[model samples]
Every structure is written in structure tokens, then in C-alpha cells.
Target chain A: MAVLLALVVAVMLVGGGIFTLLAAVGVVRLPDVYTRMHAASKAGTVGSGLMLIAAGLHAFDFAILARAFAGFVFFILTAPVAAHLVAKAAHHAGYRLSRHATCDEMRDHTKK
Target chain B: MAAIVTGLIFAIVWAAVTGSLSPLNLVLGFLLGLFALWIIRRDFAGTRTVVRPWKLLSLLILFVKELALSAWRVAVLVASPKMDLKPGIFAFPLKVDRDIEITLLANMITLTPGTLSVDVSDDRRFLYVHALDCSDPTAVRRDIADGFERKILEALR
Candidate 1:
């Protein structure tokens, strides 16, 4: 059972690392601010969460588990808000969206 | 009542799981759990307000969009010829008043590529942010207010 648990933890860490790496790559390859934000926020948050969970499992202690879980929860709660603020700051600074962008929410906001 | 009970349970569980109920570890974990409860309680203080599910959903979507967009921008800037960057500091007036919300906003700005929150105004009225290549200032402010601020206000209000 311990071996199985170790295997599971290993897989989680590896998978999370790969996802985070992909997120970094997406940040490099994607076009424009909005799209990059999408990749970074989702990948960063979920990847970090999974990695922390794996770390908790590897430790196999309740205190460490609680700390890991708490950290994960904090990440989930904050990542989105941070992303939104960045985008909002960029938008407010008059950065132009790609022509491909279908909706212009900022324009609507200015009229108000 | 439940929070206190859960706090005690967390302390006891952590102590047993670690098998080292040393006075130090127990005291530390207990303090940590108490801190966690304080944060959680403060965040959920106003239960009487109606929740806005759509606002929450939109906030998530906006964050994802911004992350992808910022990363790409940074990559291009890194690859571009002459390494030309018009980096400048801009002050963004914040409408969100809550401490948790403002902290979240500041952290988000700092995490996004090509931008960082440098400082907050003493009065908490504006945020000072540095942009890597600031070609246009108005659009940046609009993005901050309309794109992020609006969603946060909706969800937290």
C-alpha cells in the first residue's frame, strides 16, 4: 500500500510538473495578454495545487497535509483575482486587444 | 462554535499524525490553525448578502484570458529586435475597498507577466503599477478597472 501510494504521489508530481511546464510554454507561444493570462492562471493554480497535494501525500503526515491543503485552498482563492487585476490594469492602460477578440468589454465600461 | 471545535480537532489530528506531540509542534500547529480560522472567518463575514454566481464565473474566465494574453506578450517582448521596451510606471485608482480584495488585486498584478504592482497609495485610493511596454496608458487603466475590477466588485459586493 505504501508503494502504491508512493507511485500515485510520483505520478501526481510528474503530471503537475508537466502541466506547469506546458503553461510556461503556452505563455511563450500564445498571442496577446488575455490569452497568455488564461494559460498562466489556470495552469499555475491547478499545477501548484496538484504538486502540493503530492507533496502532502509523500510526507504522509496530517500536519503537513493540512498545511498543503491550506496552501492549495489559498492558491485557488487568490489566483483568479490576481489575474483579473493584471488584465484590468492592462486594459485600463489602453492596451489594444487583438482584432480576433470578439467582445470589447472595456469599451462598454468606458461609456458608463 | 464549529470553527473552534474544528481548530481543536485540527490541532489534535496534526499532533497524532506527526506522533511528536512535542510542546513546540503542538503549539505551532495550534497557532497556525487559529490563524487559518481567522482568515477564513474574516473572508466569509457577511453571509446575509446574496451571492452572484455569474459574477464568480466571469471572474474565472477573465483570469484565464488575462494569463494567456500576458505570457504571450512577455515572450514576444523577449524575442523582439532591439529589445525595445517602453517600460513606465502608472498609477491606477482602485475602487475595491476591502482589504482582502485589494490584496488579491495587488498580487494578481504582480504575478502577471510584463506588469508588477509597485506600491499602493497611502490612502489606498490608487495602485502604482509598472508596465514593461506601455504604449498606451488609458487602455491599461480601462483594462484594470473594467476587466478585473468590475468582476471583483461584483463577486465581493
Candidate 2:
């Protein structure tokens, strides 16, 4: 059981670490606030969630697992809301997408 | 109604699994139960969605697969030496009106790669979405309507 738990923890940690790193790279590389927010919110959540699971398994304590799982749930519930607000604020403030962006349906909708 | 009872029962099961009967244990169990029911809700006879649990699980599996695929696409785009992309914002007219439904759809979209839910219109008729690549708006709209919105309706009633 201990071995199995340790293995799970290790795999989750590594997988999560890579994802988190990718998200960081996205923040630095993406063209605009909107795109960057994509990287940060999505990858960040999955990465953190995996790490949280790893923590719970490593601890092997019911209370710890419950708390960690709760945190994971909280992250899922909150991250998207946070991203939505930031993106809304950015759009309303007139932050344009990268030059490669092909359309702006939002502007059209808001105009009419 | 069934879901709540299932959650309560799940809490008891959880307490047994963990060998504890504390209130906290029960609460945690309840949460797990709720989560479980939310996932397999279709299997229960009293479930409003009334789809197979496997179907619901498959939907989620598809969603996660898409999530990873999009994330990878974004990652590759960013890694490319020259970043040439067209990021556009578009109004995605919504089929869902209820607050919870709208919220769920928006969150799922945001969680998936390359899309962000900006805002909903005053009357909740349209959701303003910013797609990472909006060259094909038709495809994006279809994907949302057929995928997230459809699955949400299936799971919740």
C-alpha cells in the first residue's frame, strides 16, 4: 500500500510540475492578456490539482486527503470565475488580441 | 432529492472507509458522495438527466481529452519561433438561460484550452467569448453548442 501510494504521488507530482512549467511558459510567451489568461487558468488548475492529489496520497492521512481534495474542488470552482472576470475586464478595457487574431465578435455584439 | 440522499449515504460509506465517524468525516464523505453522484447521476433512476452513467463519464472523458489537446496546441503555438495568430472575440448566442447553466457552460469553456468566457449579455442571450484562434467561428460555435451545453443539459436536467 505504501509503495502504491508513493508511486502515485511521484507520478502526479512530476506530471503536475511539467504542466505548471508549461503554464509559466505560456504566460511569458502568449501575445496578450487574454491568451496568457488561458494558459494560466487552465494549465495552472490542472497542474495544481494533480499536485494536490499527490500531496494527499503522500500524507496518507484521511483528514489531509479530505482537506486537499476540498482545496482541489475549490480551485476548480474559483479559477474559471476568476478567469472570466479578468477576461471581461480586459475586453471592456479594450485590450486587443495579438495581430494574428482574425475576428472580434464581442465588439460586434456589444455595438448593437 | 435522490442526489442529496445519495450524498448522505456516500458520507456514511466514506466514514466507514476511513474508519471514522466524526462530523468532519461525514461532511467530507458527503462532498465525495455529491461529487460521485454528479458524475454518475445519469445512472440513477431518479436522475433528471436519465442517461447512462457511462455516457456521462464518456462525455467527461471527451472533455478532458479535448482540454489536453487544446492545451498542447497552445503550447506548440507559443513554442513556435514566429507567433502568427488571429485572436478574435465573438458573441456566442447562448441556448442556456438559467444562471447555473450559464455559469457551468462558461466555466467549462474557460477551463478548456484556447477559449475564455468574457461576459454574458444583459438579457443572458449571448455569451461573449474570446477564442485563441477565431479564424473558424462556425466550428467553435458548433463545438460549444454540441459539446459543453449539450452535456450540461444531459447531466443536470
Candidate 3:
């Protein structure tokens, strides 16, 4: 049982670490701020979630597990909202995406 | 009724797990549970209901999907040059009325990279958020309203 638990924890750590590395890359390489926001919001949340889960499993305590689960829940609840706020801030600051971009929803709303 | 039940269950679980039901620890647990109940009561306005299993399953799936997509995007971004950032703030109209719901929304916004919830309007209708990279303000607003807002509405409502 201990060995099995260890393996699970290892897998989670590796997965989360890889995801974090990918997120860092995306933050640097994405064509625009919005895309980068996408990278950060998604990767960061998952990586953190996985890490927490691993910790919970390793601790082998219900309270720790519950707390970890709660943290994961919190991450899911907030990540997208944070990303949207960042994107909105960038747009208001006059950040422009490539001309290939298609829609502009906030602008239309403001016109009304 | 719920509080008493929860407290009783928690006490039993705590005692069983720790093997020490010292008076001090028992009192502490009760106090913590009371605090949790109080906070929940304040935010939910006395409306209490059992959580639906299906909702929890769906939420878990949604979170996984969002995580994978975001990870891929971040990988690409970090590999690029010119590091051009367009940061600014925009007011977001909120549909959630419950204090817990709103707080959850605010925390969610803050957790996502490159964004932060700055302020809430006096009337509580709009939230001002700052974005690290704002490619399109309107798109951002719509995404928040549709994505997070929609999910939160479903979960909390």
C-alpha cells in the first residue's frame, strides 16, 4: 500500500511539474496577452491542483486530504475570473491582438 | 439540525482519527465547526441543501479540461519573444448576488495568472479587474460572464 501510494504521488508530481513548465513556456511564447492569459489560467490551476492532491495522498490523513481538496476547489472557482480580469485590464490599456483576431465583445457593449 | 449533525459527525471522526478526544481538542473542534456554520449561514442566507453528486462530477471534469488547455497555451507563450504585455482594468458586471458566490468569483479571478480583481462597485453590480495582457477588452468581459459566471451561477444557484 505504501509503495502504491508513493507511485501515485510521484506520478502526480511529475505531471504537475511538466504542466508548470509548459505554462511558463506559454507565458513567454503565446502571440498575444489574451492567449498568454489562457495559458496561465489553465496550466497554473491544474498544476497546483495536482500538487495538492499528491500532498494529500502522501499525508494519508483525512483532514489534510480535505484541505487539499478544498484548495483544488478554490482554484477551480477563481482561476478563470482572474484570467478574465487580466485580459480586460490589458484591453482597456490598449493592448491589441494581431489583425487576424475576429470578435470584440466588450467594445460593442460599450457602444450601447 | 445540520449544524448539530455536522458537529456530531466531525467530533466522532476527529476522535477516531486522532485517538485523542481531549476536552480542549473537542472544544476546539466544536468552535471551528461553529465558525464554519456561521460563515456558511451568513453567506447562504439560511438556504441549505444537500449537494448533488452530478454537479460535483461535472465540475471536476470541467476543471480538468480547463487545466489542460491552459497548460498548453502557457507553454507556447513562455517560448515566444517580444514579451509584449498590454495591461489594463475593466469593469465587469456581476450576476451573482450571494456574498459567498461573489467572493468565490473574486478569488477565482485573482487565482488565474495575469489577472486580479481590483474592486467591487458600490452598488455591487460591477467588478473592476486588472489584466496583465488585454488583447481585447470585450472578449475578455464576455468570456468571464459566460465562462466563470455561467459555471458559478449553476453551482451556487
Candidate 4:
């Protein structure tokens, strides 16, 4: 049982670490603010959530589980909304998509 | 009010399962009790988050698939000798109006391969999303409507 629990924790930790790394790579590699925000918000939250789950699983203690869970909930709630705000602000500030970008409805105001 | 009810339920369940209300157990119960209440009341009072676990599982699988697929696509686009990309902002008309529903749709779209949820209109009638490739706006809108929003409605309702 202990071995199984350890394995589960290990997997969750590794997976979360990998996804967080992927999100970081995406942030560096992606062309523009919007895309980078995609990496930051989506992968970032999932990665953090996974790590918190691992923490919760690794320790059966209630205090640890409670703290981990609180963090998880906070992350899940705040990250996406923050991303949306950043994207919205970027749009209003006229952050154009990359050179290859094909549309800018905000610029034309036609999308409104 | 709902949270109180949920917390009490969690406390009773914890006590029952452990067969002892020791101090540690009580503390654990209290801690988890709050969490349980929060989760239980987060979406709706007197209602549940989603109706079906199987449906949520399907959604999770689909989401993971989309995540991997999109991440790969974006990575390939970035790694290619020449970048072939067409990005744009498009207004995805909102059919899901509830705050939670809209939030779910937006996050799902953002996490998927090539999109980001930017904002919703003042009236909550339109969700403005930025797509990494807006070459086919119609196709994009159709995909979102058929893909994320459809499943959200299915599980949520």
C-alpha cells in the first residue's frame, strides 16, 4: 500500500513537473502575448493542480491535505481569470498578433 | 448556508468512517469539511457541480487529447524552419450564459491547442477569444460550439 501510494505521488509529481516545463517552453517559444498567456494559464494551472494533488496524496495528514487542497482551489479559480484579464488588457493596448496573424477585430472594431 | 450543511455532512462522514472522533480526526474533519463545503457550494447552492461522473470523465479525456494535440501543433509550428502561422481575434457568440458555464467554456478553449479566452462582452452575449490561427473563423466558431460548449451543457444540465 505504501509502495503504491509512493508510486502515485511520484507519477503526479513528475507529470506536473513536465507539464510545467512544457508551459515554460511554450511561453518562451510562442510568438505573441496571447499565445504565451495560453501556455501560462492553461498548462500552469494544470501543472500546479497536479503537484498539489501529489502533495495531498503523499501525506495522509489532514493539515497537509487541507493546505494542498486550498492551494489547488485557489490556483484553479484565479489562474484562468487572470489570463483572461491579461489577454483583454493586451487587446485593448493594441498588442498585435504575430506577423503571421490574420485578424485584429479589436483594431477594426468590427468584432464589437 | 449550503456550505454549513455540506461541512456538517463531511464531518459526520469523516467521523463515521474513522469510527473515532479523536482530536486529529476532528481537525481533519474540520479542514476537509470546509473544503467539501467549498466544492459543494462553489457552483450552485442546493445543486451539484455536474450531474454525471462518466460525462465528466469523457470531458476530461477529450480535454487531455485536445491539450496534447494542440501543444504538439504549436510546438511544431515553433520548431519549423519557417513559421507558418495566422493568428487573429474573433468573437465567438455566446450560447452559454451562466457565469460558471461561460467560465468553463472559456477555460476549455484556452487550454485547447490554439486558442485563448480574452473577454466576454458587457452583456455576456459574446465571448471574445484569440486564436493562434484565425484563417478560418467560421470553422473555429463551429468547432467551439460543437466541441466544448456542447459537452459543458450536456454534463452541466
Best by TM-score: 2
lDDT of 2 by residue, B1-157 (tens): 6678768867976775576779988899999889887887565544243345665786678777876676676667666788666788888989887766798789888877678899998889999888887888889899899988888777666
Model 3 regions lying over 4 Å from their true place: A59-66, B1-30, B36-157
Report the CAPRI category for model 2. Answer: acceptable
Kept native contacts, fraction for each prediction: 0.03, 0.57, 0.31, 0.43
**Candidate 4: how close is chain B to the reference, as a TM-score?**
0.75
Model 1 chain A weakest lDDT span, ten residues long:
A100-109
Docking class of 4: acceptable
Candidate 2 clash figure, as a count? 8
Q: Model 2 misses residue A64 by how many Å?
A: 1.9
- Least accurate stretch of 10 residues (summed lDDT) in model 2 chain A? A62-71
In model 2, how large is the Cα lDDT of residue A45? 84
What local distance difference test score does each model get? 0.69, 0.81, 0.67, 0.77
Best-first order by lDDT: 2, 4, 1, 3
Who is ahead in DockQ, 1 or 3? 3
Residue range A1-112, candidate 4, lDDT tens digits: 9999899999989878877787788788778888788677767677778899798878877656666766776676687678888888887787778877787765555434
Q: What TM-score does chain A of model 4 get?
A: 0.89
Off by over 4 Å in 1: B1-157
C-alpha-based local distance difference test score of model 2: 0.81
Cα lDDT tens digits for candidate 3, A1-112: 9999999999999988888777777766665676566667777678878998899889998767767776787687767666656665676686765443444434444556
**Residue-level lDDT tens digits of model 2 in A1-112:** 8888788899999988888888898899887898898888888888888899799878888767776776787787899899999888888898877777788777777777
